[model samples]
Target chain A: MALHYSPVLWNRQKRLYDLTMAGLMALYLIIFCTLQTSLFPPITTETIVIRATSTLAFLMLHVILVIGPLCRLDNRFLPLLYNRRHLGVSMFIVAAVHSVFSVLQFHTRGDVDPLVSLFTSERQYGSFGQFPFQPLGFFALLILFVMAATSHDFWLKNLSPRVWKTLHMSVYLAYALIVMHVALGILQQETSPVYAGLMGVGVLTVSGLHVMAAFIGNRRELHPNAPATDGFVAVCDVNDIADNRAKTLMVNGQNIALFKYDGKLSAVSNLCRHQNGPLGEGKIIDGCITCPWHGYQYLPENGQSPPPFTEKIETYAVRCVGTTVWVNPQPYPPGTPQTPALLKVTTINDEN
Target chain B: MTPPLRRAHRFIWLLLVVALPLGFLATRPTKQSPWLQEPVLPPQSTAMPVLLRTIDADSLVLNLRQSVRGTERQLEILLKQPFETPSAVVCIRQEGSRRAVGLLNAPGLYRFPLPTGTNRPLVEIVDDVHGRTVKTVQL
Candidate 1:
């Protein structure tokens, strides 16, 4: 919800989020280092740093990945989704530290360049046991660098939400690479089953949550099977929608958000202009349909953000006939004003 | 998220559900334990014994042997005592270039096939944790 882009539009919530993240990261490092030093007396400082940061980054990545599906499954996790970029950036920094120390420790001693040695050190590509796992990690780090670098809204705006989202989706590839990196690298040396078991649980949890969320999302999609009358599809009764909230409907290949607010009904594109967040999941706050993901707002009548904000979404023609809300699936141009279909006072009373 | 992205997400996880477990199963270590085998010196080997000391002043007996079969030269090393430091490696340095022979995990006989036509090779036992050469021997 910014008019102009700066380095970071920090607010009280963002500041609190960052502070909490930093504190938790530091606490994790302290606990991990303490346990490592006490358990393994012969471990070096570099090894400890490498292990601690790598584990922290991996754990943070798991948390970051799960946050998305968790939000989709339950709105209670939306707060975590709001500040996820910070978590991603922090994870990248920690992962970069791990990559730096690993290269310094393992590859710097060689006569050839560190990067060259990292790729060419073990040329057992044909063999699964000796596959070059470090390169996978390096490429994963590269993807993370790109994601962390373009995490700001400025890039999101310039690149467009679709491209930005597609680029950020590479995090899944990075996660896969990291999984293989660990499976083929450290898991080979470490005899303990605990490490492998924990990794298995992480993979299962991430994949499982995503699958469940997708299933729930598919089930929740409102498909209008009722026949259309005069190009207007009867989506639901006016009282079916909660006040100030919306019910998303798919009519004539259009995803529409039918919002009921102030005894009136307005229909707009379900997709928010900002990051394509689900507008239907959001509620009208102060007469603006606020996006649930990042609080990007749009006026219910015209699908345009309030003054000073240029963002807009497509507005659909909606009308109420005998308490049944009918919406024209064809969308008007973004920011085009449409008269909201007024619900009967009796309908409002029935909702109450 | 858009419908396409949702489909892609589901597809990616579906693939991962199959691929990850397969990868984990495929990469499981299949090689035999090196420690289980008895330490046996190679036959027809010329042993060049050398005394090496660690930074902690512990003496180590390193028996380096070169067994030449036709044009191939193999370097065989037999350590009398176990290397106490974890992640230690035996490296061969020839003309300013160093190459790790193998991990020196336990005191035993180890064989590494050497590159042909090398002069004045130096063998060093390095502590990988500290990144220091603990002991060195010229051959």
Candidate 2:
């Protein structure tokens, strides 16, 4: 987070990510064109580039979508989440190349205006098999342009994280449009079942991954280790938690993670502010509870990230009696400093 | 980045690189290549007489008649639908030889040169969009 806007905050990791992405994009175009020319002679240059870029951008989008849920399911996929915006912008660039070349190839020399032709080329909207798909692609590209233009953190800060997230979610809408664009446009003319089968595989892969991730998250939320008590929920025994680790508890419909760190116990909201990452799954590093996804951290005592970064989460009151730990269902505001629950001297030996 | 995450990033790049060749192989075209097909004549019946009738909304008309210049034939094709640049080709095939005669976007009479000693030549028109056959006339 920054008070003032800069084009980008480039770090070593971001540089490497962008460079690799660009190189892969270039390599894809080169290889695609080479194979097209070699396998199918007489293919025009414009057609080759247009198809290559469209397929490349489509493939990149699928990868981007896969990374999100994959990262949520496993922390090992976190690096893809770091420079995801860069990949998004690159996809947009490739998509734009496809859109331009398509217009030039299909609409340019027609009697009507190019834009008009794009809309009116296939006038049979009444028939689903022959629907005018260029409009769908055009609108999807517009949404992608909006998303790419505002991918920077500057927009995230000004628009608020919630709004930015909501806006970005329109990517799913664009994805739907792209699916229809291909289904009604290219798939209509393409007789080979291979292309259709590939498209189906892509759709199913993305949908299946997201559904699996959501199911796993929901199962974790539905069942918690904490037993129901009067007002406070009895979490795991004080000895059950390892140093710098947490025992996740569900209290009053809220997931609260009770952390044991530096011989003290603290409870904070399990949900990370960014992307709703699971905080309980993360461990304390450098005195801060680091989120397994994207590495966003929050102080254990107060659910606030370190100074200069304004991200925060709700903190809960907790206490340890003998060897057992209990947490109050009530939660304090973000950044509220709740006193750390003291561990009993007798319970110290119980920690393994 | 953590070691595991860094490894994942590298894996994604590798997958992307590998996906290119794999995608091409998976989508290998199976349709008969136009180049590989024998230069066979289009469907034939009787030669069409000359006419100046208006073209249909969705069809381009090909008027084939004996050329005034010689025993050669001429084709007066009119495109009722919008087409790309004036690069459409009128292909004529007789026996084994196939000749592609270029035509402009504007309606005009094009010299339909056929192989010598050929009486009836099969004609096919290929447009810029998709290389689809816009019109075919057997003459």
Candidate 3:
């Protein structure tokens, strides 16, 4: 497929996004450096961690909002699209930190249960003027957790993608709740409007991007299918399939890839189970073929992930005849898998 | 994945979540200083005029603040003793040649640093807590 995507501008934009996140965090701390000693946290390790984690969480929400529509604006953004699960997971991590640190600072005393104490505090569940509970903030965090858990391909496979997408979209509602929570809970207590304004800006930016996606993205055209393969007929020259890297092949009425890496070469399903990202387009690292879109790595031999990760994909058989390679497209028994038959790479171009 | 590895991953995340807050609540501190160490004692002679708390006799230390005034000094010692005088000039010292180390404020804390040795007979302290007492001692 000779599709011209991955525009130079889009790559530049990605680099810019990465740098901007780093710069924003630096600026955030620099602005507060003078007040750190005077603040409630007052130069403690825990306080630093709390501030850092909260700042990171806010950054992630903005990234989520921006990246979605940006991909729609250009084809290159599609790669960013494929790995959004990892991004969501990363966001959950920071949010978890912020929540924990907050509970520790506010609710813990002697032997009291921290979770119980959060609700029990008079400052939380009070009257309207003092309506505590931090219900808005907590609600937001709970939604984040739900989204993170369901961000995996397993969930996409188990739960229909449409439902999964809708459920995960509740993050936007969670985002709104978080804004109110922060504004009322923290900014109100401090009598400062600066934080409130910043939060509003973050929410607006994200919401704006989604609105743009809705306008431009054609739901019917997304994920168009490819012409199915005929029989087990290999495409790429054997020489082009690098050691541990993948080269796309049309074989035995299916699109598969040949992977040679980590002292092993094998054939397997070409479509990324997560988002149908081309498995062949990804490179191999540390014995695992990492999806270039989101860096989800899989073992090439049997497509099993390293222990504890449990991600796996179907495998296929392959053979080499003189200068060319061949693959049998029938998928193998999954679950507990072994390397597909390996064919010795006999260099044809060496003599010619 | 085997059940154990799957469980390990699940538990690690749980620990991460739990440890984040629980850790913050669980960590506190303490206070110990060098000033509490006892200072060395001078030779044990009557000339030093030191009173003894009878509970501990073999091992001792002294750190007396030196600021004495008046030709007739008052010695208030929290120790076992024989009343040796009334309204008289006194020279108190180790059980030896006459020399005095008068006591202006004697009721001070005495810490028993170490257990007594059997080689020396025990020192005894006798005192009445609730009593109208007039202490006039000659050394």
Chain B TM-score in each of the candidates: 0.51, 0.43, 0.23
From the highest TM-score down, the ranking of the candidates is 1, 2, 3
lDDT of 3 by residue, A1-352 (tens): 1012232223454565545655765676666554675675447867777777777777777777677657645547765665455566777887898888888887785367887666655453434334553566677889999888777556766785445655765765676556555544555444344654666566556555555544443331122133323333444456766676776654444556578765456776665555444566677888777765556567777777667666577787655545466565677765336545445554434322
Q: For candidate 2, what is the TM-score?
A: 0.71
lDDT-superior candidate, 2 or 3: 2
- Native-to-model Cα distance after best TM-score fit, residue A161 in candidate 1, in Å: 0.6
lDDT comparing candidate 1 with the true structure: 0.83
In model 1, pairs of residues that clash are none
Best by TM-score: 1
Model 1 lDDT per residue over A299-333, tens place: 99999999989989999988887788888899999
lDDT of 3 by residue, B1-139 (tens): 1122223433433443343223222211111121232242322222223333223222222322111331221222333333332221112333333232332223333322221221122222212222222332322
Query: Which structure among the candidates has the greatest DockQ?
Result: 1
Clashes of 1: 0
lDDT of 2 at A14: 83
Give each model's whole-structure lDDT: 0.83, 0.73, 0.52
Q: For candidate 2, lDDT tens digit of each residue in B17-83?
A: 3453343333334322223433533323344444323233344665655534446555555556545
lDDT of 2 by residue, A265-338 (tens): 99998877765566887899999998876578999999989998888889998878787787887888989999
TM-score of 3: 0.40
Of the two candidates 1 and 3, the one with more favorable DockQ, higher being better, is 1
List runs of model 3 lying over 4 Å from the truth: A1-41, A123-129, A218-352, B1-139
